[model samples]
Target: MAQEELKSINFMGWRKTIGAISILLLLVSIVSLAVNGLRLGLDFTGGTQIEVGFAEPANLGEIRTLLVEQGLENPTAVYFGSETEVLIRTQGAMQDGALVLIGNRLEALEPGAQIVRVERPAAGQAGLSQVIVLDGVSAAQVRDTDIFDRTYFGNVEFAQVEDGLAVTLENSLDVAYTNRLLTALSEHANTDVELRRSEFVGPQIGEELRDEGGLGMLVALFLVMLYIAFRFQYKFALGAVAALIHDVILVLGFFSLFQLDFDLTVLAAVLAVIGYSLNDTIVVFDRIRENFRLVRRGSPKEVVNFSLTQTLERTLITSLTTLLVLVMLFLFGGELINNFATALIVGVLVGTYSSIYVSANTLLALHIDREDLIPPPKEGEEQEELVP
Candidate 1:
């Protein structure tokens, strides 16, 4: 059997405070953005890297010293649980030469240790500086460069090789080869390598991903707003949209302040968070709508407060259950899933706040009229009409 709806509380009682709470959440989000800039993962920033695991565990400092001697300058060497597995990052400047020096130096440092081959990534030929975000384009804006119709132009920066244009792509030239033996995906298909992979997407691809991903999110939000508006009133829908945007800004602020890698995967997680937060908001709004119908004596704020209290147990229970699973994934899912899990954890907490403190509070601020929500009686009171 369906669970009976809980009795409504006096919702409008502390609406002003609830609104303040919503504003506070938004404020926290703003502060996070300003201070903790999100860490952008290598996925978005273009760079070259090398990961070599030794059969016999070796010294990290010694290896780092060797890498520095190899002209890598300042190298970042991270140990993944043991001395044998190490992750190294090198600047894209002279990345190709650095890779060779690293291999040679490691051989010199550990004479007996087996030196594995280094893997290099494909360099992006295109850049985003040429691309411009435009408002309305008129016919006159079309220049000899094909400005209006064609907004994006791709130019590949080729690697200098002994033989010209060693690599090939349509309408794009190979990067000038510099000792860096770029990854040959065709050659390494299906076989799993010991070195776990981390990718640095070129600005071109990052821009594409960013543009397309952003568009998708905007469309999703627009559709959600449209649906909510149709179901309730325009003001109610606007409130929902406001709450959702608040959640998104807060999440972004956290990422920006911390300098989190804003990759496609991270973007995907943000979208999921928006939808999840909206779902929570809708649940609260649905309850509020029902209460407005059931009771006419109470003001909107009392109705909202009552509705929140009634739904409090259910909301917390759901949030806690999800949090429990996410915490497990976060603690044990390994490095690959850490960021994604962290995003979910933050989203869940923020979603809960927006639902209890944001969505309900929004309805009150809109001054949603119970008379508008509830149909006028046919010459009778609600209680009289309900009776047989």
Candidate 2:
């Protein structure tokens, strides 16, 4: 079967209107980012992450309320991989005396329930530095302990090495504090609740990550500009970079305007968007360069319109296929990646538009013509021998 040839659509005819809309959107996004900034997540704002597993499916609302009652500020509880597992995050680090206070409170609840600790190196893994022992707790009291802490513990085994239950500590957390929190949850729900893992991220570390992420994006853009300039012309490189910047700003603005959680994964998505938009813009630029050398009777605008029409089907098909996958991920990939998917979805849409209008318009604005893309004659070759 023969493929049908696509007709030229005069894409440049509405360049003025599209350019105005792009500028309007860019201004709005810049304003929103300046005024409403992104909502940083636990990954970028240092905090405590606690993962707990219940014998049955957990109630997120009830868990949040319990955490608040225990004086955890702005606790956020969401289901992890399963309904029975819940991950909780808070903005503050654990206090120095928090373990002692929790131990005292638990003593009031369960008299003679002693909290004991014995420290030792984790078996087989020299990298792990500590192990904690709970002297008086029963196996039933700590039911499914290994399963709950699987994320952090990896393959380390827990057993009754001595009279006490020996559980390896992935990080140096107070044993009493964990036991007390587990006991409180068990008592509240009348179910065996296990502390899967607890981790603390300091504010300083979060700040460093945030700064590094921004720096990384800037570096990527700079490198991209250099590559495009070397591959094509200076005008083409500038147009490609402009399109990329347009895509990035609009994506960031969407997140800020909606106050979405901007975390490490979303940052990754933004970078991926830059790559995606760049690829699309480069494809269009390649076509434009080819048309400039081949077509002899058109102005730069007409040449660009013809080039765009030639690649329109390819661009739309690629963007649509990519968007379909992103939409599915956004809807069904769960809470952990919802924001990541959303950032990409917006990026893909904005990137498609920018590649078509922003890059092409910039080329015409800069007065790009066949002369810019023409190669200089070799050192020994005569200028008259070169074909115009």
Candidate 3:
């Protein structure tokens, strides 16, 4: 009876129009991706990310100018959480060079301030033991400097050894790099700057992650196709895969078009989109299959329209509730997860549309019929059981 009421609305009647719109969006997305390409983030591209907090509000323009003057190429500085916090990103790993620069600047600050590097005992183990020798100045002078703050050096403890002030470093190059970067910023800014956090990704690792991520997406799609085929039919599988691909491409294209950072988080969101769209498509397909076997005296188009209308309310309710949470996350989640939330938001919307239009349209385009979904009667079984 519910199916009979829904049959009044010809959902499939707009297939041609929706198909044209989908094709147009797909073409635009493809061309934009081919031309502009995605803006790969620090995770997928080799780079250093440093977050620092200042005693007062930081001036991004001045900070960028200072970094540029220091010979750091293409340094990007933006507000992290508040006006007093700044996040900086730069291409390539500059730890070694930064350490050398910081050492030189330290010597220039105090005539006899020297940084001595002590080799660790184990050959296979990484990192070095560093000490500060105040030959011409007292420990008090060193403590008075802006660089003496404990927060400037991440994961390093400073203690007075018998010879000089010993600085034990942990986590290898990351600690050393953060110390150097913070020292440089403090020296230049001449203010109290605290190191919040630091991250460095090698170019080789970034390339590997990018490659592996793409391969993973492809594998997921292939497995989805196989699962749908085994669960339903080849026609349904083809349609489901088509919709998933459409959702993925459109999501990627959305990032490319806007030049948003495409990171591991965004990639994860795209995969989630595939799963969400697949579930929605499967639900609609399930109803269509059930209707194909139960409803008599209806064409394939009429059956599909009835199935879509029957599931429309469910689909909208699920999508809207999910979108509500996503929207809140986007608005209040902070800078660290803004892109992640944006990707999910866009994916959910596109996924919903593709499930409704692209997947259903593909089934109709393939000339799906009741005979394709209805299984043949077993040997010696009555033919009446197969009648719909």
Candidate 4:
């Protein structure tokens, strides 16, 4: 049998240089986070998220500008699922009849644009169910319960039931809340708007979510450290934990430096990055431990190089294949998940680097000798008595 040939690349030979580069980038990221901070999305800051659709592609910048002109606070309009769909987010709770104002402004911007949907944080199993019929009645003529007061409907078919008007509403909301949004559109522009969805979330809930997200990440890291320590040597655990931390910091830095929307989704991605970095580090560390026992004569650095070389192809293939999918998602998965995909892409790239440089380098710095990984037999060991 022939040993597989490998590229004689000196990974450890450039350790100091890579370390310096990593440290510098981390410092820059910390500085950026302190100065620029992150752009928090509605999920973190507490606000309303309204999803609207147009008969054709509408201008996002124009919509944003128009919302601002209407005195909406810090309105952000971005493509939702497609160019024809836009999701608008506003900071703080919307003022009374704010939804109507938004619908009016949207109608003015693009006559075809309409408030197809609205979503707020759910309160509970609270809603309305009613049946109403009216003749020659405008939306405003309906009572508060007869309009867009429900986030969902069992049936809202106008074609199936015909006469003057027939509506059987289930789990509906107050007309003043979501219904007014619809009335504003139909009344002002005489445009038919569909009530897609609506809900409400308060700032206190956002704060709770923000705290929970941070706590979740901390718990994940602590658990990873404990698992690695029990599975291998303490030094191995330290190396793996350090690598995970390095990957996370780099990912967070990327977000902060770019001022990307750091929402709950991105926080989930960071936790995922920790898992990926730990997996890669564990793979290399396992090989190094095996080499310490089998190939008895080499310094820790030589063993580290050999282990990395053995696993290099596997690492590249896994990382590259995962990255390929993430690239596709970022390019074509639409605006709903672009940030999530972006976070994963950056994590895979940096996680691979940390597995190689950060984790292995920590083992070397810890002076991991053969005995640390593979214990020596006790001196003058006596054979155990056999039960005959």
Best by TM-score: 2
Compute the lDDT of residue 376 as modeled in candidate 4.
55
Superior by TM-score: candidate 1 or candidate 3: 3
Off by over 4 Å in 1: 1-14, 31-37, 48-200, 375-388
Please identify which of the two predictions, 1 or 4, would achieve the higher lDDT against the true structure.
4
- Please provide, for model 4 over 1-388, each residue's C-alpha lDDT reduced to its tens digit, 9 standing for 90 to 100: 1123323357899999998998898898888878988887778888777776566666766666666654556767778667766676777654434445535644554464444333332355244344444334334333333333344343332312243444444533234334444444344434454545444567888899999998988888888888988888889888888888788888888998988888888888888888888888889889988877766656667777888999999999999999999999999887778889999999999999999999998888888888887665675544433333
lDDT of 3: 0.79
lDDT of each: 0.61, 0.80, 0.79, 0.71
Provide C-alpha RMSD values for all models, in order.
14.7, 10.0, 8.4, 10.8
TM per candidate comes to 0.62, 0.75, 0.73, 0.73
Candidates arranged by lDDT, highest first? 2, 3, 4, 1
Candidate 1 per-residue C-alpha lDDT over 335-377 given as tens digits, one digit per residue, 9 for 90 to 100: 5567788788888898888887677677666678776675546
RMSD of 4: 10.8
* Ranking of models by TM-score: 2, 3, 4, 1
For candidate 1, the lDDT comes to 0.61
In candidate 3, which residue pairs get closer than 3 Å at backbone N, Cα or C atoms, i.e. clash? none
Q: Please identify which of the two predictions, 3 or 4, would achieve the higher TM-score against the true structure.
A: 3
Winning candidate number (lDDT): 2
